[model samples]
Target chain A: MNDQLIALFITFILVAIIVVIGFMSGRDKKVRSSVEEWSVGGRNFGGLLVWFLVGADLYTAYTFLGLTSSAYTSGSLIFFAIPYSILAYFISYFFLPKLWAVAKEYRFTTLADYARGRFDSKLLSALIAIVGVLMLIPYICLQLSGLQDTLQVAGKGYINVQVIVIVSFLLVGLYTFFSGIKGPTYTAIIKDILVWAIMLFMIVSLPMIHFNGWNPMISHITKEAPQLLTIPSSGPKAFPWFITSAIVSALALFMWAHAATGVFTAKSANAIRKNAMFLPLYNIILTLVIFLGFIAYMVLPKGTNPRFALLELIHMSYGGVAQGLAYATIALASLIPCSIMAVGASNLFANNIYRDLINPSVNGARLTMITRCMVFVVIGLALLFGIFFPTALVSLQLLGVAGMVQIFPAIVFSLFWKKQTREATIAGLVVGVIVTFSMYFAGKSFGINEGFWGLVSNIVILLLLNPFFSKRAGTNAIKQFLFQK
Target chain B: MRKVLLIILIALPIISQLIALPFVNSIHPIIVGLPFFHFWLVLWIFLTPLCTWGIYALQKAEGSID
Candidate 1:
C-alpha cells in the first residue's frame, strides 16, 4: 500500500482503460479473417497514424531507458544514436518508398515477399523472414527486461518482478491479439502525445528549474565525465568497424519484418517519407531522455540499476500525478513496441514459417490466429528471461541488431542489382551473418559494441563474395524485374 | 528447409560467445549525463549515420568505379 505502488496502480488503470477502449473500438472481429485485415489494419492507416506508429516502433522503451543509462555512464558516447537513427531514416526514405510502391502494387505483406518479387526467390524471402523473426524475439526480450527493471525501480520492493511483467504485458498482448495493428497504433497515438508533452515539459522545465540552463549542465557533465562529452580520445569512433556498423544499422533499420509490416499499414509511401522528415523532432524527447539520465546520475546511487534512471528521475523530481504519469509512459514505451515486435515476429512465423512450411494450405484467418498465438508465446519466453538473466538484455538487443543487419545486402542490394541471383543473396546472407557475428564477439572481447566489427566483416565478405556467386542472371528473370519496373 | 536453416542461423549469437574474438581493447570511458552504459546510444545516433553513410558512399564509389 505504499504511495509509489498505489501510484503505479493508478497509472496501470489509466493505461488499461485506454487500452480496453482502443481494443474494443478498433477490433473488427468479422474482418480478422484475412491477412490484409489482420496483419495490417486493412492496409488503411493515414500519414499521421502511420507516422506515430513507425516512429514509436523504431524508438522503444530501451531507447529512453538504455540510452539515458549510456549518457549517465559514458557521457558523449550516447550521441552515436543520433547518427545511426538519422542514417536509418534518410536511407529508408530513398529506398523504402520504392519498396512500398512495389509492396502496395503486389499486396505484399512481408519483406520476404519483396525479396521474392525482386530476386524471384521465395527461399531468400523466407530466409530473411526467419532472421527477422528470430532476431526480433530477442529484441522483444530486451523490452520486457527493461519493463521489469522499470517496475522494480518504481514499486521498490512492494511488487514482485515476474508478476508485474506478466500482468503488465498480458494486457498489451491481449489488446494486440484482439485489436491487431489498431491496438498498438491507437496506443501509440496516446504514447506519442505523452512523449511530446513530457519530453518538452521536462526538456524546458527541468533545465529552467534545476541547473538554470543546458550550458551549466553541459559544463557539469564535462567536469564529471569529460570522456563522455566527446568522442573517444583515440579519435572520432575510430577503426573502419565503427563506420561499417553505423551503415549497417541504417540499412538494417527497415529490413526488419516489423518495418515492412509497419509500412504496409501506411496508406502511401508519402506518409513514410513525410514521417522520416520530422521524426527527428522525436529526437527532441531524446534530449530529455538523455537529461533524465544525467539527472539520475547526479542524484541516484551508482550501484542502483542504470536502466531505472527515468523512473528514478520522475520519483525524485515530481512526487504525485507526474510520477504516476512518468512511470506509465516508460512502461508504455516498452509496452507499445513489445506488442508491435511480437505481432511482427508472429506474423513472420504464421506467414513465412507455418504457411510456407508447416501447412501450405493454411487460410488467412488461420494464419492470423497463429500469428496472435505466437505473440503471447514470444512474450511468455521474454517474461521468463526477464525474471532470470537480466544483464543479457543489452547483449540480446545488440545481437538482434547485428543479426537483422545481415539481411541488408540481400534486401537493399536487390533493388538495383537485377542480376543478384538467389544463390548470391543466400551466400551473401550467410557470409554476412557469420562475419558480422564473428566480429561482434571479437569487438566485444573488450567492452565496446561488437556490431561495428561484425557489420564490417559481414559487408566486406558480402560485397566481395556476391559478384562471384552470380556472374550472370537468367535473361528471363532480368526481363521480368527490369520490364516489370 | 529455409526456415529450418534460419533456426540454425539464429544460433550464431550463442555460439559466438563460446569463441574469442580479436582486436579487443577497453577505453574505460568515464561516466556522463545518463550513465556509462546509455550515453553511447546518443553518440551512436549521430555517429552511426555518418559512418554508415560513409560506407554507403564507399559502396557507391565501388559501384561507380566498377
Candidate 2:
C-alpha cells in the first residue's frame, strides 16, 4: 500500500480505540441518572482528572493547527497563545476556586445557573446561556474544520473527507449523549497522552532530522526570513495588538462554557487551585507547538496554504504509520474537545433556557434526558453551520473570544463586589456585545484589540450605572456566593 | 503582608507578558540560539507556574485553602 493508505489505516485503528473508550466510559448507571452527574461527573473529579480534562478540553485541534499556521503566516503573533494561557491560569487561581465553592453550594451546573442564582434574575441567566451557546457554536465549527483539514491531508484525494467528518461527529454526538461528561473525561486521558507524546517527539526530532540540528534551523530562518523571529513593533498585529490580545484572551479564557464545565467538574476548590498551579505545564508544550510553526515555515515551500503547514510537513517527513498516528492525534484533538463543548453548550440550553424559563416543573430525570438530547442538536447545528457558511463561521469565531468576554463583568464582579447590581451588569453586557460587534465590523480599532474597546465601554457603563442601582445590591445570594464555604 | 505578596505573584505574569513586551520585543541577543523575544516568553511560560505556586503556598499558609 501507498503512504497515504498506510497512514489512513493507522488513523482508523487509533480513532476506533478512542470511540470504544468513549462508549465504555459511562458503564456506571449513576452517571446517567441526573443532569449534574451526567454533565459534570457528579463534580467529584480530583485534581489529576480535572487537569487532564481541562488540558484536553482547552487545547483543541484548532490551537494545534491554528497556532502553527499562524506562526507560519504572521510570525511571532502566534506567541500570544503562550502568555495568554499563562495569565489565564494565574487569573483562574484566584477566581475559579471561589466560583467553584459557590457553584457547589448552589448546585449551579452552568455559568447561567450562577448568574441566575446570584442576581435572582432569570432574564440574565437566559441571556448568559444564549451567549454561551452562540459563542460555543463557532468554536465547535472550528474543531470541525480542524478535523476536516486533518482528513484532507491523510486521505490525499482517495477518501471522502466530508463524509468522514460528519460520521465522526455523529459518533461523537452519540457517545456524548450516552456517556455524558464521563466519556470525554475518561477519554481525555488518552487524548492528552497521545498529543503530548507525539507533539513532543515531533518538536524535538523533526528539526534535528531535517535541518541537522536546532541551531541550524534557527540560523536558516534567521538568514532567510528574519522577521519571523520577532513581533513587529508597528502594524496591524503589532506590539500593541499582541499585548492587548494576550490580556483580552486571558480574561476571556475561563468564561468560555467548556472551560467553566471543566472547572465545575472538580471535586474541591483546592483541586481547582492545584490545577491552576500545574496547568502552565501545558504551556510548555504550547511553546513547542509554536516552534513547530516556525519550523514549518522554514521547511515547507513558499505559497503553501498556511492552514495545512504542520500536517503537510508531517506527511512529507514521516512514513505511513507515523503519519497516520500524527493525523489521528489531530483528529482526536478535535473530537474530544468537540464532545466537551457540546456537553457544555447543551447543559446551558437544558438547564438555564428550557428548564428555568420554559418549564420550571421539569423533573431531574427528564432534565438529564433533555441535556443529553441537546448534545446532538448542538453538534448538528455546528456541523450544518460549518457546511453552509464556512467563512461566516470563521469571522464569527474571531468574534467568539471578544463576545464571550462580555460576560466577565456579570460573572466575575458578582463574586467579590458586594455592590454589584444586576441592572448594571445587564446594561454592561448589552453595551459590551454591541461595541464588540460594531468595532469588529467597522474595521477600525485604532490598531488596538477590539475586545479591549468593548470591555472598556462595558466597564464604563457598569461603573457609572452601578451606584444608581445600589438599592438591589448585596443580596443574600451575593453573600452566599462570597462566603459559602 | 501575605495579601501584598499574593497580589505581586499574580501580577508577575501580566508584567512579564504585557508590561515588558516593548523592552523585550526584539530579535537580537539570541539566548541559547533563541531570539530574546522567544526566550523571554518561553522563560515566563515556566516561571508563571512558579508564581502561581507561590500564591498557592501563601494561600495554603493562610489557611485559605486546605
Candidate 3:
C-alpha cells in the first residue's frame, strides 16, 4: 500500500511537470491576451495537433475505467462501444463539416453560437447554453472521481483522495487558466505517445505473457466465467439498461461541449470530415483496454474494485515502473479532459451568458478572464459534488450522457433542418427535457436508470410534435436545408 | 464507390461479431492473426482514409469546395 501511494505521488508530480511545461510554451502574451487564445487556442490547430487533442479529449477516463468495468462484469455487449464510436464519427463527418462551414461563415465559436445562428433565436441559444452547463458539472465530477479512484487505489497508504483531487485540480487549473486550450493541446501529444505505447504493448505483450496466447486466454475466461463473455442480464434490469445506455451514449457523445470544442478547433470543415474518417482506429486501442478489463476480471480477486484492473495488471505483473507509466497515463487522461471540459463549460458561461446576456458590451479579454474564473468555479463545484455525493461513477456517467444526449435533435438535426424554427425547437427541447428528467428521476428512484425512460418520452414527444410545427418553417427554409450541398 | 466502401467497412463489425461469437467461435484469419472483431475494425480504419481521400479528390474536381 505504501508503495502504491509512492507510485501515485510520482504520477501526480509527472502530470504537474508536463502541464506546467505546456503552459510555459504559451509565452506569447499577445496570444494569451484574448478569448480566442484562451478558449480555442488562437483558433489555429493543424491536423497533427488536432488529431492528438481531439483523440485525447474524446477517448477519456470513462473509456479507460468505465468501459473496462462493463467489459469485466458483462460480456460481448462491450462491443457496442467500438461500433458506436464508428457510427458517431460517420454521423459527425456529414453534419460537422456543414456545421464548420456555417461556423466559419459566421465566426461561430460554440455550439450555442451555431444554434442561435441557424435558428436566429437567442432564447433557443440560452436554453442550449443552460443544458450544456448543467450537463457539464456532472461530467467534470466524473473525471475528478476517476482521478480520485485511481489515486485512492494507486497511493492508498500515504495520501488521501481529497488531497490528490485538490492537488491534481490545482495544478490543472493553474495551467488551464494560464494557457487555456494550448495547455491541453501540447500535453495531448505526450498523452497520446504514452497511450499508443502502452496500448500496443499491453495488447501484444500481456495476453502472451499471462496466459500463453489470445485463444488460450479466451478459453480460460470461458472455462472460468462463461457469463463474462455474453450479455448476462435478463429483462429490463441489466440488458435494457445496458442497451439503452449504449444508444444514449452514442447519441449524446458529440453533444457534450467538449466535442464541439474539439470540432471548432479543426483547420477546416473538411479536416473535421477527414479526421472523423479515421478516428475509429483509436477505438482499436480502446478494444485492447476493454479486453484487458475482462482479463483482469478473470484473474483478479472477487472484490477487486474492477476499475483499477489495468493499473493493477501492470503492477501485479510488471511492478512499479510500468505501473507508474500506466498510472501516469490514466491520471493524465483524467487531467487533460478535465482541463478541456472545464474550459468548455467556462466558454459557455463567458460567451453565451456573461457576454451575450449580462454585459453585451464586454471585451474579448474581459470575457477570457471571466472564462478562467468560471472554470475555477466549475471545477470547485464538481469537486464538492464528487466528494459529497460520491454515488457511483458509472451512474453519474450515464446521467451525464443521458442529459447531454437530450440535445441531439436540437443541435444535430437543426443544422440540416433550417425549417426548424427557434420557437418550435424550444418547444421540442422544453418538452423533451421535461419528459427526459421526469422519467429519469422516477426510474432512478425505482432503481432503474432515469435516462432510458426520459429518452423514450423525449423522443416520442419530439417526433409527435415536430410535424405540427414543421410546416411553419416555410419554403425558403426548406430550400436552404434540403439543398445544403 | 465511396458509399459502397463505407457500407462494407461499417458492415464488417456486425458481420464479424456474428462469426466470432456463438457461431463459428474459432474462425481465425479475419486477417490471419487478428481476432475477428479487432481485425474487422482495423480493416474499417484502413479503408476509411482511402475512401475519404478519394471522396475529397472527387469533390474538389467537382467544385464542392465549401
Which candidate number has the best lDDT? 2
TM-score of each candidate structure, all chains considered together: 0.82, 0.98, 0.87
List model 1 lDDT by residue over B1-66, tens digit each.
Answer: 544543443333212211211122122343443433234344444443343344344445556211
Model 2 agreement with the true structure over A1-485: per-residue lDDT tens digits: 98889999988898889899999997888888988898888999999999999999999999899889889998888888888888988888878988998899888889999998888889899999999999999999999999999998888788899999999999999999989999999889999999999998898789987899888888888898888888887777787888888888899999998999999999998899889888988998888898899888888899999989999889888968888988999999999999999999999999999987899899888889999999999999999999998868556876899888999999998788878888999999999999998999999898888998999999999999999999856557557648566
List each candidate's DockQ score.
0.05, 0.82, 0.25
lDDT digits (tens) for residues B1-66 of candidate 2: 888898888778888889998899877788977888889988887898899888778877888675
For candidate 1, give the docking quality class from DockQ: incorrect
lDDT score, candidate 3, position A60? 73
Residue A143 of model 3, lDDT score = 83
Distance from true location, Cα of A95 in model 2, Å: 0.5
DockQ metric, candidate 1:
0.05
Residue ranges of candidate 3 with Cα displaced over 4 Å: A1-10, A232-234, A237-245, A444-485, B1-62
Give the runs in model 2 whose Cα sits over 4 Å from its true position: A481-485, B1-4
Cα DockQ of the candidate 3 complex: 0.25
Check candidate 3 and list the clashing pairs. A5-A155, A440-A450
lDDT of candidate 2 at residue A334, scale 0 to 100: 97
